[model samples]
Target: FAALARLAAELPPALAVLVGFVDRERRGERTLLFNAVALVRGGVVEQVFHKRLLPTYDVFDEDRYFESGARPLVFDAGGVRFGVTICEDAWNDVDGPLRAHYDVDPVADCVTAGAQVLLNLAASPFTLKKRGLRPAMFAGIARKHARPVVCVNQVGGNDDLIFDGTSAVFGPDGSLWARAPSFQEQVLVVDLAPAQRVAEVPASDEAAALDALVLGTRDYAYKCGFRLAVIGLSGGVDSALVACIAARALGPERVLGVAMPTRYSSEHSRRDAQALAEALGIAYRVIDIDPVFQRHLDALGPSLDALGAPGATDVTWENVQARIRGTTVMAISNRFGHLLLTTGNKSEIAVGYCTLYGDMAGGLAVISDLPKTFVYKVAAEVNRQAGRFLIPENTLTKPPSAELRPNQLDA
Candidate 1:
């Protein structure tokens, strides 16, 4: 309210604000807030709009934090009656992914209330499909209402959620009129009247995928108040790709690549990790974990013998190596305040191929949503785009393995 008061006091007579903010309210026995937007004009608040639809699936838990609003809100802006919809409100369109999730049509209600334009303010997360999904939905809304719809979305990575700005304006005929750049901040000025030119779609699938990861990495580090990053270099496609992304996002000077080798670690694997760091011009450190692993085994052997338990199983020993590496990397991160980037791909993470506290110990998981097969594709794309082997060719070709047991290979 304080922020709104200040803004309203200085609000230009020709302009009005429809912006989102956290709003608090009290029911009979409960006090809760709403993901809300306030309409301000000429030093006064016209209406306080609360978000009606609260998504509670996957990473979204807005239902737990906010109260649902009752109805739609319409306010005048620059002689045009604009309807306001929060992030999920505009997603209630029939053709959208979550159409079944919402029962109310907020946009339709706005149109019934005599709004000339629909303005949706959103902070929606970016999944791979959202690159194409958002524009299609907005265009569909414009065509249905016969009114221009403008969507302004939050950009940059917030933890696991990456918001691709890609803010867009769609004409009543469902033509893309203006589009902001993806994964970055861009100002788009479009005349309220019919657009004279159509907006060009800027990015391809592969390019957008790479940019999304890069922007996510960069924004996650910056927003979390860290400038330096630490990555576990395993000489596999997953870790190699993560290292490349971290170097690109945070710069070589800010990224530190650590290669931890154990008794089972192959010589070529260690060499490949070092080569990657050198090629990327990032600081590199090699830590040998054989001594540490041996000490752990020696210490635990007596306890196991006393318990008369079966000797350490394959999984048990594998976890031991992973945990040791995790511990070492975490210690370095704590000492230097470098945000550790975990390198487990989606395929490994999905089937529990990774150790919980071991390889998964990091401030960020860069490629956890990416499958193992796609990891190679991204690595190849990276090299192809750079016109050289940014990641060593051997790393890309070798069969992936944790190297915790003898003659082990991931096929």
Candidate 2:
């Protein structure tokens, strides 16, 4: 109560503020209900709107801790009347009474009371395609009431339930005016020019997708307490792009690039990798893994030859090289206490193209969700933003290869 009073005091005068809160009280009943509604302005809260519907099925336990309130909350804000509802309010036809049942329809009451806009605040959890339903619901509400509607959602991964906070707004004509990015915290500011009715081209969906991935990477790394990220630079596009993202998110100094060359690694690849590292201004190391590979092959030569598998076979030799490189990188990661970043893209992961426990060995997969095509797109955007080509042009143009075995292309 004191905190609310202090916040209200600091807020601008005459501007209406609606706060949603859950009320808990021990009545004669043994069961509890989760209640939510608007805290009206002018120091008086008239209507008590409650969440009549509660999900008890999967990954939810709302019915265990709340007593549902029994009315629709309609309030005045900035000379335009508005209706505020909680998360489950939109799903129910009527808010029910008693410990478990209350009868009130906030949406109907808002329309009856001439609400110009309807606003809903929610902490809805994410399920596969659950977000797709929000657009239709908001659009239907706007078109039905002949008023604009705004939905604000809380976003973040909360335990087993991830709240994808893609808040959306619709005009009176049921057209989407604005939408926030998913799976992240963002404050979306939209200018409500009701008089102009000018329809601008919708923003690029690709930009939003990329931004989400970036945010996901940043948050996962930082929240997981990884201060330094190390990548195995093969002079290929995947590793280069991952290094770029890590540098951008955690600063260049925090990202370390290790160019582990072998007999198959070309001189051009090494030069390009070095150029990229210099351009990004990150710590770089050239660890030759040829000695390590040869030692392993020599040690396993008797067993490999006795098993009727030739050492020169492409598959056997390539896999041995990849495993050796993986082992070397893991050893470096353990010694230096740096987070090893795996450089496999979605295209590789989807088709099982990546060497298991080899290139896929990392604390977190940065580009696991991005396809090979999108990886290049993001790299291009990064270079475009840098003005000059910070990422080496040769790195981007050259065909990607693991360079694991001698004379072995990534076929």
Candidate 3:
């Protein structure tokens, strides 16, 4: 807090900075830590307030860190009593899913303490449903309390969690004053006048999803020190979607598409992979696994003598082909120092339809969270967003297949 106060002292006198950080205070004889937001002005820290509510669900484990504050923080600022809350403080409502867990509604408590406006500093991560749901939730809170609400949410990706920074302002009558863009950073300055409402057009679900994926991929690679990406192009929707995301995330020049074709590989699949790579203007290469695959068969033939080593007809041989393709991609990843992207979808992974070390081998599973059905939807959105057939039409219309065996289909 002192360091932040010192930094705040350097700012212009007209501007006040609200900074969130860990604060240490003396309680009795023991020093305790708190998750606090400090209001700084006049070359010093004017006031500081702790986060009252701490969530301990999903990726959050606030209880394991600093202690929760005992009371709400309501202070006078610019002739208005501004009520302050942290991320989890505003999450608990009488009508919410966590109604039974807590005995407090921070927003209501703030209003009870004579607050005219509410400000929530949040770091909420992005999800498919939550993107649209947050505004409605905040608007409801504002209407219920009859106070204008401002929520400034963090934006950017940190590992697997992606924060879509859609900071917004809602009037006391539940009118939207302003809304920042998703997955991007912008300084939003909205006048408190009730007459100046910006008519914001919400992004479609597919459009929001595409932005999320692109931001996630870009942040994950850049944060992990990866400048290039590589993908195993199976000529299927899942791999195609991943490839398109990679192209957009880390420019087409930084992406490599590899197709490891074997005897069971279809001609159309090879063509589709090449065409998709070409359409994206990414690097394309084809590797035939016949030599290494046949050597593996020859070396393991004696061990499988009792288990019927009937050439490539055995069920276990299917896994071998997938593993060879996996190895082919990983080898390229190692040689080029690229981030390898896996192409398995949620449905296939849930039912254990994919091989263990085969299709699952990669630094990142780009489309693993998307189900087979949703994968197709996003793939279409990719083309629609481009206003052209970036992914070939046949790839979308054709039946899904792994092509690990001759005349094979995922069905």
Q: What is the C-alpha RMSD of each candidate to the true structure, in Å?
A: 2.4, 6.6, 2.4
**Cα lDDT of model 1 by residue, 1-411, tens digit:** 888888888888556777678998877898889899988877787789998888888788998888899987888766778888998899887476756457898889999999999999999888767777778889899999999999999988887788888888889998877777778887677786565444444446666677789999998899899899998898888899999999989999999999888888899999899999999999999989889999989998788668876654437778989999999999999999999999999999898888989999998999898888888888888898889999999998888888888888976
Indicate the residue-level lDDT of 365 in model 1: 93
Model 1 C-alpha RMSD to native: 2.4
Window of ten residues with lowest summed lDDT in model 1: 195-204
lDDT-sorted candidate list, best first: 1, 3, 2
Clash pairs for candidate 1 = none
lDDT, candidate 1, equals 0.86
Q: Which residue segments of model 3 deviate by more than 4 Å?
A: 26-31, 94-101, 195-202, 306-314
> Per-residue lDDT of 374-394 in model 3, one digit per residue for the tens?
999999999998999899998
Could you tell me every candidate's TM-score relative to the true structure? 0.92, 0.71, 0.93
Q: Ranking under TM-score, best-scoring first?
A: 3, 1, 2
Weakest ten-residue segment in model 2 by summed lDDT = 93-102
Candidate 2: Cα lDDT at 186:
67
Angstrom error of the Cα, residue 242, model 1: value is: 1.2
Where does candidate 1 stray beyond 4 Å?
26-32, 96-98, 193-204, 302-313
TM-score of 2: 0.71
